[model samples]
Target: MQPQSLQLSGIRKGFGADDVLKEIDLSVRPGEFLSLVGMSGCGKSTLLRIMAGLETPDSGTVSIGSRDVTNVDPSDRDLAMVFQSYALYPHMSVRQNIATPLRMRNLSLGARLPLIGRMTAKASVLSKIDAAVNEAADVLQIGHLLDRKPAQLSGGQRQRVALARALVRSPAAFLMDEPLSNLDAKLRAHMREELSGLHRRLGATFIYVTHDQIEAMTMSDRIALMSSGRIEQLGTPDELYQQPATVTVARFIGTPSINLLPVEIDASGRVMALGRPLGVSVPARYAGPAMLGIRAEDLRPAAGGFAVKVLRSETYGADRYVTGHLADDQAVCIVMRQAAGDPIAVNGEGLSHLVFPEQRAHLFGADGNRIETTVPARIAI
Candidate 1:
């Protein structure tokens, strides 16, 4: 097994009385691409900052390559980060910008000068820096843009220059904070493909932080889903989608999101929804009020399913959504929808019956914790 290149042990941070992060444990394997994702105010950005050594944590240890780097300065941590704003030097040429780190690192206090340095024999240092800068530009396909300043570059070009600047140093890992957020929707999608290809070419560890679930789902090997300053779940996209550990995670992921219905358990370990037997075999501990989580794909018209009137139908270009209201009262969970042309089940009068496949049905107990159980048999109405 490869050792982890980046590790955060029991990390925490807070702003005075407000807690921004709880004890968070994260690991990034060497050459692995990991994404930290969550909504606004979820501390995702804060965590990324901590990883970059830009923000000091209230408590916890940060280690890189088996060495503790908790007190290391951001610049001394030997890591490069790309910001969302693409903070390029407006007046500097692309080559100068890309060579900035190397110049800063290679030059001595007495040798680095505006006029005096030009007369000194620092040819070797300058040559090495130029080679590194050009090599990184070539790899990023930005060699042609080296002579242009940031003002003259397009958004994509600027982004590649920023990436090239970061990569020139050959840092241990790349830290990206919403790097693609500034791009338009179509460009963002295109960049996603390009970034994946770049990752393959470099084989370097990537730690990306973003609010976009699709970005995390498609690009990362695994994701740490954070919420309210704490990690809610950590797993693959399929794992979280197919088997969410809690209601929050289930609701957070997916295109249309999963529909959760209020339900109750009977004396025989059976779940009752809309005052009818669901035929779902719930756990013995389930009783009183519980919620039934059903994905849009799991929803259909019911022959014996709980009856609800259709409110409306939503149609997209390629898909039509069948959304409707349920007779049950309490909250909006009763309302549901599914893709059109689904053979699942629905009443003729816009009534929605959640007909989840026995193998696909998910059960959550009254405590909001998902209960592990098999899907209930579909009854033939």
Candidate 2:
């Protein structure tokens, strides 16, 4: 099937007096897997529903490959949506569920009944449906479960069945709204690999909506990080992680969260953290209150850096994370990579010196926007 590009322009939506989507504009490339990710009530699902023609936007247009589909019906939009719920018929077998779309589209009402329809239906139509069903089953590796009902299959198998049903249609694009949210952790991880592999094999456009940043980071070609009613940032996983445009984007995209410390710029334009000079300089224009953001990995153990008293420590196999508080009442965390030879111990009373390289730090202004700064050639560590 030929892939189609999906585009949304000037999209806005509201409920009663509350505005949900505000001037949303996004363009999805052909055969690309784009994820719309944000917390609940961020309007990611609503934007997806508009793309699927499931909901009408208050304003703006939706186009698929140059054809406007804003006002089109869901079925006529040439899009297939897989909801969070499996939405499979409990009484239908896997084969029947996979064949439902083809059957509905190709068969007449009188030709769809139990025994009478079989006699009235064209042999060519039945044969085509069977071929499509088998092909979809084979693609999903669920051919052996054709005779099983939804009640008999595992959650992952049921999800695959639902995907197969969507696959049989060969729609222009696929819109999935948290389809794997119900699966257990291990199964969800497995399904992430499966879905990514399926996208590569099919080369079909995929718009995945989820609240999980991990899901978006792992599988998407580009992530559209939605917040409130707008896209805060849209870029590849690395770009969003390493260079976030706002404090919200930085806070939302990483695991264990980025550590933010209140900072300020001295009269000499030097950045200061915990009331101590950080040996980094910002522009004279930014000589005021700021926020210093650093990832746990960047906070390394240095010989004579700022002192922090360990408050707690947690181990996860090969790594240990020590959480502590600075003398100035600022919280800090250091991720110690476990290694042989040198053994490090973290306890409630232990004191450690932590330092983050000047280049590794992120400076945000009082309004939560990133502040571009210049580092001095010489620095005291």
Candidate 3:
């Protein structure tokens, strides 16, 4: 299938008095993998449904390539939707299930009736449908399980069958709504890789919706991070991680969660945390109460830094996470990521000083918006 661009313009939706999607405008490139990701009730799924024609927006237009598809039926939109449920026919064999879409599209009403339908369909059409089904199954590596029923297959196998069902149609785009959520952790990880490979092979547009940032980060070419009916940030995985547009994006994108410290941007542009200069500076216009954002990996044990009383430490393979509360204020806690072999010296009082590099720090104003900063050449401490 030739990949096509998808666009949603001025989308707005509400449930009763609660607004779910508010003027969402997104454009997806042809053959690009875009993910709508966020926590529950963030409108990611609703937005995806609007694209699939499963749900209609209160206002807006959905277009495929250059054609408007806002009023088109789900089937007529030339898009295949794969749901989280793996909606397979429990009684149908994998071959029958995978062939269902092609058969429905290619056969007449009378030609769709089980055994009798087979007699009414053209020999060529039947053969074509069979070939398509077999090809899809092979692509999904499920050719060996073509004769098995959904009940006879594992979670991962059933998922492949579901994908095969969608693949057989050769749709312009695939809209997936957390299709791997039902799998175990290990299987989910493996499927992420498989999905990436499949996208490369097919070169078709894919719009994926998931609450898992890890999935979105690892698989998507670009991610639309939605929050409270708005896109908090839209960028590549690395862009979102290294330079989040808002404190919410910083908090949501990382595994350990980015460390947030209450800070003040003084009139001179120096960042102060607990009345001590953090050796960071931002625009003077941003002077006011602010927040300091730092990733765990950026914070390290340094000689003359803010003190944190060590509370806990955990090791994961080659990395170690040390969590502690600010010594000056117990309300503030910090987590630092370090190499497993790195030595951390804790005084008798179980205190360690953790400091972040000026260049790697992030500053967010009181309203949660990111504030651009400039790093000074010399340390103030």
Please name the candidate that would achieve the greatest TM-score relative to the true structure: 3
Could you give candidate 3's per-residue lDDT for residues 1-381 as a string of tens digits? 689999999999999999999999999999999999999999999999999999989999999999999999988898988989999988899999999888878899999997798688999998999999999989999999999989999999999999999989889899999999999999999999999999999999999999999999999999999999999999999999999999999999997888888998889988888788876788788889999898999988889888899999999999999999889889877898899999777888999987777788888999999998876767633
- Give me the runs in candidate 1 sitting further than 4 Å from their true place: 1-4, 333-348, 352-354, 375-381
Residue 148 local lDDT, model 3: 91
lDDT of 3: 0.92
Off by over 4 Å in 3: 377-381
Candidate 1 vs candidate 2, lDDT winner: 2
Candidate 2 TM-score to native: 0.92
Q: What is the C-alpha RMSD of each candidate to the true structure, in Å?
A: 3.0, 2.4, 1.6
- Point out where model 2 deviates above 4 Å: 266-269, 330-349, 378-381
Best by lDDT: 3
Report residue 139 deviation for candidate 1 (angstroms). Answer: 2.3
For 238-318, candidate 2 gives per-residue lDDT tens digits of 999999988989899887688888899877778888877886778777888988888876776676777777776677766
Better of 1 and 3 by TM-score: 3
lDDT of each: 0.81, 0.88, 0.92
Clash statistics: count for each candidate: 4, 0, 0
| C-alpha lDDT (0 to 100) for residue 171 of candidate 2 | 93
